[model samples]
Target: MIAYLIGNIKDKYEDFVILETNGIGYEIFIPFPFDENYIKIYIFEHIKEDCYDLYGFLTFKDKEIFKKLISINGVGPRTACQMIKTYGIDQLINYIILEDTKSLSQIIGIGPKISKRIVLELKDIFLKKYSQNIYSTYKYDAVLALMALGYSKLDSQNSVNNIFLPNDTTEDIIKKALQILAQKV
Candidate 1:
């Protein structure tokens, strides 16, 4: 079982990332997909109970905070991931610090009871730890980035929003988008 990987970020996505490690590319996904990408990322692997999964974070401390997240009794990996994905590690940690169980409960699958329990059990651990980096890391975001190119308005934004990072400048956006379009032929 691979505990973690360090490599050149060959590709990055909202749900998955490909790292080129030791001449091999590894495919990894966070427990839950973030709604946005604040920065490119790094990840920790958790393989157990018949599952091969990844939890991504901008820093090693973020990964540690995620570990604290899943430890809550009912949280599990998916729920923990949902919490992070819904509000990000920073926001969620902020909620816990501020005693905002209501916001945490709003996450899908996190009922009132579970929300309270999450706050009760583990809030203190993550209170001030995740402040360093919690937002996304992608440049210009994928959506605005596509529109800034020439992918029409709706089609480009939606497609870029849905796919992974196209980490490049405006010129690169045009070149890559055209390359992607050409592949359809």
Candidate 2:
């Protein structure tokens, strides 16, 4: 398993990115757009009988969550990518924990039955994993604060990542995030 990739992006398409490392260009499917020309990202390498694919995520947790999503009987990599792209990890976890089928069903290929299945199957796992993590709350709050300030979730996340400090309060995080977001515009 190729667990990580550190490289300069050769190209970015609608659903995938080509990262060049050591004369090799690896195409990695991504759930959201990333701006940096150079990236160091966690990777999930999926191999099947017919194809080999690599999926990248900015955070290790997101990659782990993606693996879990693909472990479900009916969910595949494409569906999992769509899920992350549509709802993001925080919102997806929130919907699952809250059993918000209506919201979950909004993703393409996810109907009421699949939504309920996802919620029922993954709620315990997500809550058990994330409930006690203080960072999760901070991430959720920062995302909401950024969204309230008119930044999309993808932009907010890119801005807020790697900026959190242990001593920083939620307000401090939001302020720092806003500053970073402003610079990108």
Candidate 3:
């Protein structure tokens, strides 16, 4: 399997880009638009009986999320790409964690059923994978405090994740996260 590709962009299209590497061009469908002349993309190759396609992501996290999304029934690669392109990885995760099916259903191709399925299937997976760190308890409390202060779950989690220190208490994390959030405004 081709894991990744580092190349110069040869052309840009609505959903895909032509990347040239080693005197070869690869047409890769991307989740979002990129303006860089060169890039390193984590790739997911899809093979069918008579077709082969490549999906490219800017980060390994994005590629992993895409894989998870496509694993759900009724969620195709294109639908997964659209969801990511529309809501972004962080906000999408937030929506899933919160079980905000209405928000997810706002996407072009995602209906209520698929949105609910996405949330139901991925919520535990995300929480387990992302929140099982040594400081998970403290981090979770800090994130809840930030959310109570009216910050978005995405912003709260992001601040907490960035500002957490090994020795800090939940209150310390909250204070540091507030400082980080204040700097953004």
Candidate 3 wrong stretches, greater than 4 Å = 131-185
Q: What is the C-alpha local distance difference test score of candidate 1?
A: 0.63
Q: Candidates sorted by lDDT, descending order?
A: 3, 2, 1
Which of candidates 1 and 2 reaches a greater lDDT?
2
TM-score of each: 0.57, 0.72, 0.71
Model 2 weakest 10-residue run by lDDT: 131-140
* Quality of model 2 by C-alpha lDDT: 0.86
Task: Return whichever of 1 and 3 wins on lDDT.
Answer: 3
The alpha-carbon root-mean-square deviation between model 1 and the true structure, to one decimal in Å, is 13.6
Per-candidate clashes, comma-separated: 7, 0, 0
Question: What does the lDDT come to for candidate 3?
Answer: 0.89
Residue by residue across 1-185, what tens digits does model 1's lDDT show?
44456667667777667767779877766644444423445666778899877666666666777788777777776677667777776667767765688898887788888888877876656544543321222323444666655556666544443443434444454455556655654
Candidate 2 residue 42 C-alpha distance from true site, Å? 0.9
The positional error of residue 110 in candidate 3, measured at the CA in angstroms, is 1.6
lDDT of each: 0.63, 0.86, 0.89
Candidate 2 lDDT over 6-102, as tens digits, reads 9999998999999999999999999977799989979999999999999999999999889888887678999999999988888777777767899
